[model samples]
Every structure is written in C-alpha cells, then in structure tokens.
Target: MTFSSSYLFSLTTFIYMGAAALYLIHWIFRVKKVGFLATVVTVGGIVIQTVGIGLRWIESYQLGYGHAPLSNLYESLVFFSWVTIVVYLIIEWQVKQRVIGAFATPFASLSMAYASFSPNIEDKIQPLIPALKSNWLIAHVVTCFLGYASFAVACGLGIMYLIKNRFSGASEGIMGVIPDCKILDELIHQTIVFGFLWLTLGIITGAIWANDAWGTYWSWDPKETWSLITWFVYATALHARFVRGWAGRRIAYISIIGFASVMFTYFGVNFLLSGLHSYGAQ
Candidate 1:
C-alpha cells in the first residue's frame, strides 16, 4: 500500500470508531451536539476512505497492475464498508433519522478493522488474474457489494425493529429513539427491494463475466448456487409481501435470514468450499 492510502485508511478506522461512540451516545442521551459531530465525522471519514481507495487505485497503476482496487478480498472489504456508509448516509438524509447510525456505523468500522487486522486475509494488491481481467469485474463486484451493503443495513434495522417492538409499548426510555414499527418496517422493505434489484443486476453481470471468462453462462458453482439460493429467499419474501401481505415482524425476520444467506455466499463459500472463484479465498 502507498503511504497516503495506508495512513488514510488507518485514520478512517478510528474516525468511524469515534463516530460510532458519538452516535450511540447521542441515541442514548439525545444529545444534539454529539449527534451533529457524529454526522460530521462519519462524512469526513467516508471522504477520507474514498481518497484512500483512489490512492490504492493509483498505487496499483504505479505497480503496473493497472486495475481497479476491487481485485481482491481486502479491496472488496474496504469497498463494502464504504458502500454501507454511503447507503446509510443517504437513508439518514432522506429520512432525517440519526439514531440508526447507532446500529449501522459499527458494521462499517468492523469491516475496516477486520480487513486491517485479520491474519487470515491478504491485503496486497496483485494483478488481476485472467478470469478477473474484464470490464465485468467492476460491474459484478460493485453491484453485488451494493446489494450486500443494503442487506447489511436491513439486518441492522431488523435488530432495531425487534428491540423497538419488544419494549415499544411498555418501555419508552429503552427504545425511545427507535422509530415506530411502521416506519421501521417500511425502511426494511425499501432496503430489501433496493438490495434485491442490485443483487439481480450483480447476478446478471456475473453471468456475463462468467461467459466472457469461461464460455458458459450458468455453471452451478458453489458461490453461484448460494447466490441463487439467496435470490430465491428474497424473492420469496417479496412474493409473500406482495401477494400474501406479509409485513412487520415476518418481513424483518426474512430480511435477517436473507442477509445470512448473503454472508454465506460472500465469506462462507470462499472460506470453506473450493470453486472457480477460488482466488477470493484468503
């Protein structure tokens, strides 16, 4: 890693950690000033991370790799963390809610932390392999991570929902800042819909990339199979909502379940099973 990118990324970790503290404190105490500071720091950290990613891309070129930073596990984790914040910031702006950050930003921080610290992971930026050297790499990885980020947000909100629901009627102080069940349900549904679409696009892009690399459109690789299973799980959730009017807690549970499938598709397949995309394994 270049000096600039490495330093910036390290700074991003602490900035997010502090932001998480500020956000959680604000949510608990309703401190306007602290929440404002949290917002500033979160946005600032995101900007810094963006610069870090850009620097990494430049560094890749300097090393003659000449590829986007989305070429490996470390880069993808960083990208995923970045996208999660981007998605959360947008939702916080649109809904004008800050408390969700209490549940959201820690995931971003931990993703960075893990990428930085995990002994099992490799952070070096090597040249793209033959299979990954295509326009489809960017499209496939970006779209998929967007979907993953959205689902991550949905998972966080699902936890918030259950908490808010558990003490909603009886204990106002514990879950006071949490929005009502209706709003939480709607937000979860909206995120799921957004994620499902992006996952669909990611799958399509992956198919295109696969055919380009391997001369086949749909081989049932383990990762591919798990992704398809995830797609079906969300599809079933959506269908239940549209046709059977499933909503509220059921939908929230489904969102959590779908994210489990997503995690498996992302980390589990790469770690436990060998496949065509074995390069992803640490």
Candidate 2:
C-alpha cells in the first residue's frame, strides 16, 4: 500500500473512534448536539474510508495484478465494517434516531482498526488462486458480508432494546434518553427482517456458486452449517414475531442470539473450524 493510502486508513480509524466517543456521550448525557456531531464525524470517516478503499484498488492495479479487495479476511472485514456503517446510516436516517449509530459506529471503527493494524493480517494484494478465479466469488462474498453487516446492526438494536427494557418501568436518569421500549422492539424487528432477507439471498447465492465451482450445492462445511444455523435462528424469530405475536424483550433477546450466530459464522468458522471457506482468511 502507498503511504498516502495507509495514512488515509489511519485517519479514518481515528475519526471513527472520535465519532464513537461522541455518540457514547450523547447516549449517556441525552445531548442531541453530541449525537449530531457524532453523525458528522462518522460521515467524514466514511468518506475517508471510501477514499482509502479506492486507493487500495488503484494500488492493486499498479502491482500488475488487478482484483477486488474482498479476497482476504482483512479486506473483507474492512468492507464488512463499511457495509455496516452504510446500513446503519440508512436506518438512522429513516428512523430519525441517532442512538443506534452510537452503538454501531464503534463496532465498525474497531473492526476496521483491527484489520488495519493487526500484524498477522497481510495487507498486500495477491493473485487469486485458480479456485477463486470466478465472478461468483464477488457475488457470494458481498452478499454474505452484507447479511452479516445487517445482523450486526440488528445486534446493536437488540442491545439497546434490552437496556431500554431494563429501565422501562423505572424512571432512571439514563432511561430518559432512550426511546420507548415499544419503539426499540419494533426497530429490532425491522432490522432483523432486513437482515434475514439479505442472509437468505446470500445463502442461496453461495449454494449456487458452490454448485457451479465444486459440483455440490450443499456440503456440510463449517461455514455453511453455521450459516444455516443462523438462518434457522432468525427464521424462528420471524415466525415468533409474525405468527406467535412475540415482541419486546423476547424478540430483543432473539436478535441478540441471532447476531451471536452471525459472529460465529463469520469468525468462528474461519478460526475455530476447518472448511472449504478456510481460504477466506488471508
């Protein structure tokens, strides 16, 4: 990577960290201006992040081997963070709620910083192996990570929901800053629904890609199994919400568990288990 690109990445990391801190203060103090400032800083960080990714892409070409940056764990994680922020921004805009971004931005910033700084994670662009030399790779990975990002937002909302619920009955100082429990519950449900749709599409795309590349649509690989498990968890959540009239704390708890599965699918399968997706790690 060029020095300029590395510097841009570093700058973005710092901005995100600052934004997260601002958002946290807003949450704790119930200060609207702090949240607004946090949003501004977060947007600035995202713009810098976009430039950084673009510079990395350009640098890849300069190295005489052109490939999208989604090939490895580090790049994927950075892209995942980007997607999470994008999705969170959209939700924040739609709901007019700055509180969720308070939780989401820190996670995004932290993940990006981890990917950028971890010595074990290689930042160099490399040629794709023969197995990965297909268009399906991009589609499959993007969809999967988008799904993961959506669930990450859902997880944040779930956390807020639990906190809101804990203080629902009591007139605590912090409770005044949070939205109503009903609103939190609804937000959690909406995020889960959005995440579930993307996750379903992601899984289907992966299955199709696997069939094209390896002649098997469904192999019980660790990654695949974990993804299936995540699907089931959210599927159950959806059913309970729509069919069984489940809401509030129960659904919030499910969202938490669903996101935990998302983490396991993303990280656990990469490190804790062996599978066809092991090559995903850089």
Candidate 3:
C-alpha cells in the first residue's frame, strides 16, 4: 500500500491506542516494564506522525498548493495530536511520571482517530483562502495550537489530579501509580502557566493577522470571542493560583473547564457559527 499521509496518521492512531493501553496496564497492574514500552511506543508514533506531516507538506507543494500542512480541520487535528504528545512527553521527562500517559495519550489517540475517521473532515490539501494567505498563518496557527495542545495535556493532568484526589484514601492499589495530589497540583499550575503564555502570544498574533486581513485587530468574531474567553479562563486560573493561593481540585476543575473553552473555540465556532474564520471548518 502507498504510504500516504492518511495511512501514516491511521497507523499513528493505533500506535497511540496501544501506548495508552500499555500505560493503563502499567498503572493498574504495576507493570514497570510496560510503562517504559509505552513511552517508547509513543515516541515512535510521534516520529512517524512527524514524517507524515512533512510528507503532507511536500505533497501539498507537489499538488501546487505550496503551503504548510496546517490549512484545515484535518491538518489542525493532526497537529493537535502531535503537539499534545510533545507536551506530555516533556512533562513526563520533567516529573519522571509515566502514569499520566494513561490519561494523556488518549487525547492524542482520539484526535488522530477523529481526523482519520470523521466523515465530516476532509484530509485533502486545498488552496488557501485569500485571508489565510498571509505569512502570519504559520505563526498564528502554530502558537494557537501549541497553546491548545498544552491545554490538552493540562486537561489530562487535571483528570489525573481528580482521580487521585478522589481516591486519596485508597492509595494502595492502582491509585498508587499516580503522583501525589500536591505534585499533580503543582504540575497543573506549571502546565497552565506555560500554556497561558502561548495562548497570550496566539491571541496577539491573531489580532495582528486580523488587522492585516480585515483591517481591524479585534473583530469579536465567534472564533475570536471564544478564543478570548478561553484565554480569560486560563488567566483567571492563574490569577487564582497566584493571588488567592488556590490549588488542588479548584485548579484542576478550572483546567478542565479551560480546555472545554478551547474545544468550543476550535470546533464549535468553526461549525456552529458563521464568521470570517469559518473557512477553518473547510
């Protein structure tokens, strides 16, 4: 079979699935070896997916589009998967915890699965809309999705936090694999801070792109509005952490809510609302 981008992405989806399972097994049955294998599988999957993305970019130029492979919903979803794993691996490296993969890899897997299987999403490389022809396209999309991917990992950490927090008393069995609640809390804050900076940059770059494309920096389009809302969500969480000394479940809840806003801004605004950015859905 031809090694098309779609085929590689499909393979990546299953690789992530297997990685997630290995992580779960590691967490549940205390299979230390499986945790290492899971990390290895995830690393291999991302390498293959990276090659696929580069191949797609080459294919685009070959087809005369001559643009980055980040032009539509399918491409964005694939990049989202890529960036999420990148961020997760970083966290794993820093914190020395592989159990988070059980929660994190699923997000990447689901994204790849959705991109590969969703009938509504087209995987073809199409011409850029005139508005998207700006050089800012790469900067804006990369920053925004980096922020999105970071939040995706943060959301997974939040879920892990909640699980460990809820089962504080049952710390002997499967729950033992998760880090301490305090560790998870601190990681949640650090992840959000990292993502917030990127999101802030994303919004700034987006506003500049808007000015170039639409003669205004802020149009309050549905996508733009929701992006601001998502920014504020993380901002509020950070503010609470810094000024109010909040932590634990409150921060975890906010992380989950913030990611919800991210999703709505990404998928909901594209599909549900008509706006200048509606071409994103295409």
Candidate 4:
C-alpha cells in the first residue's frame, strides 16, 4: 500500500476543518485577515489534494492495477471533495465572496473525514472488475463527480439563503458578510446549470460503457434509473427559474432537494439498492 496518498488525504481533512473554522470566524468577526487565511488554507489544501491524487494514480500503476484512482467508493468520495473545493475556489475568486466558504468547505472536509474514518470504506488499490476495464470508466466517473461537486456547492449556497432569509432584514451582522440573497440565488442557478451539463455527459458516457460491456445501452438498473431521476429534478429546477420566474426561497429549496437526489444517486444506490453499479460499494 502507498502510505503517501492516505497521509496527504488525512492532512487534507484536518486542513479543510481549519479552513471552515477560519471562514466562520471571518464571517462572525468581520475580520478581513481571517477570511484571507481561510482562502489560503483552502487553496493549499487543494494543491496538496492534487498531489495526493497523483500519487495514488502512480501507486495503482505500480501495483499493476492500471486504472485511474477512481475504481471504488473511497477514491470517488475523495475526488468529490477535491472537485467541490476546486469549483468553490473558482467561484470565490470571480465573485469575491468568502462567506460561501463557511458553508462549502465543511462538505469537502466531511467527505474526506468520512472516507478516512468509515469502517465500511477501504483505501486499497485494486484491479478493476472486468466490466470496469474500459476507457469510459475515467470519463464517466470524473464527469459525474464534477457534477456532484457543483451540486454540493449549490446545496451549501441553499443553506446560506435559508439562514440569510430567515433573519437579517437589513442585511447587517453575519448576513452583511454574505452575498446578497439575489446574488446567492443567481449563483445557485448557475452552479446547478454547470452540474446539469456534466451530469448529462456522465450519464451518456455510462450508457456507452454499459453498451461496450453488456451489449446494451440502457438497462434500467437502479443507478441508471435514479440518475435519470436526478437529471429531471435539475432540469425542472432550471426550467422553473428561467421559464416560470421562480427565485429566492423556492429556488433555494429546490437546489437543496436536487442535492438530496444527487446524494442518493451517488451513495444510496450503492448501499441501499443494488445493481451493476455495486462495484462502487467496494
């Protein structure tokens, strides 16, 4: 086993926790330096996580497994955390919003912590099952997790909206630090749109992969079925916002609900339901 990857990931989890704390401090105290510290720590964590993923990929090659570091549950969760932070950082940079980090970073930290601490998860590098030994594996997994990461960010924004709307009539105090409700609403819409596109690609790639392995394009497996369900949820959200003039609390609630569908597609399908995608549970 390559210890480096595990070590880096463990460090990443704690660093994320620290970053989250810093973000909250910045929000509560209105301290500019603390917010910058949070941003620096999160960016540093992302850099370390990139290195860790690379090391894990190399170790898989050395073990002769010869696949991306995405064959099982542990690595997927790690990648989900990684990309969530990446997307969040880009948003933070462009929008100049640090309070979102207070909501977003904990999801990244929690993903890593669960992957590291959960007894049901294993961190070993293993050869792919015969069905997964295809080029589509990487494409499907990466796109799906990118989509998942965006949904995670959107969900965090949803929480922020709820909190901001529930209080702060004048947009003062902690609410003053957060972006405006209208801005959060726009961000939530945009994030879900980004996620929707990638998720479409992920599902298409999975269909192609299934065809190559099983001679069928759509099997209606629990995973595939639920993925379609999640897709429709986001599609409806987008439609409602653009066509139906939905905004604010309604969009925020739907974003949170959409993420719940995402979580079920990613996690529930593996443990609570079973099908060809059961390999992920390993």
For residue 7, give model 1's deviation from the true position in Å: 1.7
- Model 1 per-residue lDDT tens digits across residues 50-100: 999999899889989899989888888899999999999999999988999
In model 1, pairs of residues that clash are none
* Cα lDDT tens digits for candidate 4, 1-282: 446888999989899989999998998999999999999999999999999999999988988887899989999999999999999999999899999999999899999999999998988888888888899989999999999999999999999998888885856777777888888989999999999999999999999998999999899999999999999988988888766557778889988999999999999999999899998898
Q: Number of backbone collisions per candidate, in order?
A: 0, 0, 0, 0
TM-score of 4: 0.97
Q: What is the lDDT of residue 242 in candidate 4?
A: 63
Which candidate has the top score in TM-score? 3
Off by over 4 Å in 1: 243-245
RMSD of each: 1.4, 1.6, 1.1, 1.4
Tell me which residue pairs clash in candidate 3.
none
Query: Please, what is the whole-model Cα lDDT of each candidate in the order they appear?
Result: 0.90, 0.84, 0.91, 0.91
Off by over 4 Å in 2: 1-3, 243-245
Residue-level lDDT tens digits of model 2 in 77-195 = 78898888899999889998887877788779888888888897877778788778788877888888888888888888888888877777866576676778778778877888888
Q: Total backbone clashes of model 2?
A: 0
Q: Pairing residues by index, what is the TM-score of model 3? A: 0.97
Candidate 2: RMSD over Cα atoms?
A: 1.6
